[model samples]
Target: MDDRIDVASLGWPAGLVGELDHRRLKAPSVKLRSARAGEHGDVTYCVDLRIRHPNADEYLTSTELHSVEHFLLEGFQRLLPEHFVSVGLMGCQTGFYLGFVNEGRSEVLCACLVRILEEMQAATVVPYANIEQCGNWRNHSLDDAQRVAREILARREHWLDAA
Candidate 1:
């Protein structure tokens, strides 16, 4: 392994760069892709959720990121059952990625996330926080997740920023 490698220099999966033009999608909503999405030719769509502001901690604390992961994983499954692939946090904690099957849906994925963020804010407990249910259960915080969700809900138009 190249022990000297810098994580900061490798922000996103290089495979993702070919498809998403994240720089121009700052409007209130971001439409799903017209072209196929996936691992080059694998047909899975990926949505990279980026934190816009400078305060990374405010947007994604460790506890909050864990809670948000559970929420998005479940929420997207319920909303887009057929298309939702998976969700995961970035190592830098500045964002997360949502993956799904590319069905070429006309709806905006980012707009749909706004609704989900509202639901996350209203949740009283963090799901899958028990030791038996999670790897680092004690490291979760519903409060932090809700706070971050509230900020995201308030913004309503923050798009994925380019790495």
Candidate 2:
């Protein structure tokens, strides 16, 4: 049998906390895993949050991705119109990429993400999980996403700048 990991069973994208400074928790020669922070002259500071589901077999379904995309993109744009640029799932169904446009913006973005996760955990009905409003409405899983979010929150301190 092939011994290579399925990539999802690694149960990672968490536990990156470093003495409360939130350093990049790497898997040691497996992959490049870390949140990126940088800025341009005028554009907003880009804060990227990378994650993967604890369960590799439990990759995000289309509806799940769509629902999350809708929730984050709309919510952030509405809440942080000046900072929020874009929010979407990675093609690999591992995590999300969030963009912002201001100095010292990662804190706000990270805070918002935590808030969203908290809300997502308590939320039973996804905001746009409907056939009329969603393309793959039937394939979403609020439970799974919330589970991942909760795990992320528990280890939320891992999201910080090391460089």
- What TM-score fits each model? 0.67, 0.62
Candidate 2 residue lDDT tens string, 63-91: 55666776676667777887677775768
Residue 13 in candidate 1 has what lDDT? 31
lDDT of 1 by residue, 63-84 (tens): 7788888888878888888878
Off by over 4 Å in 1: 1-42, 52-59, 104-106, 158-163
* lDDT (C-alpha) at residue 121 in model 1: 71
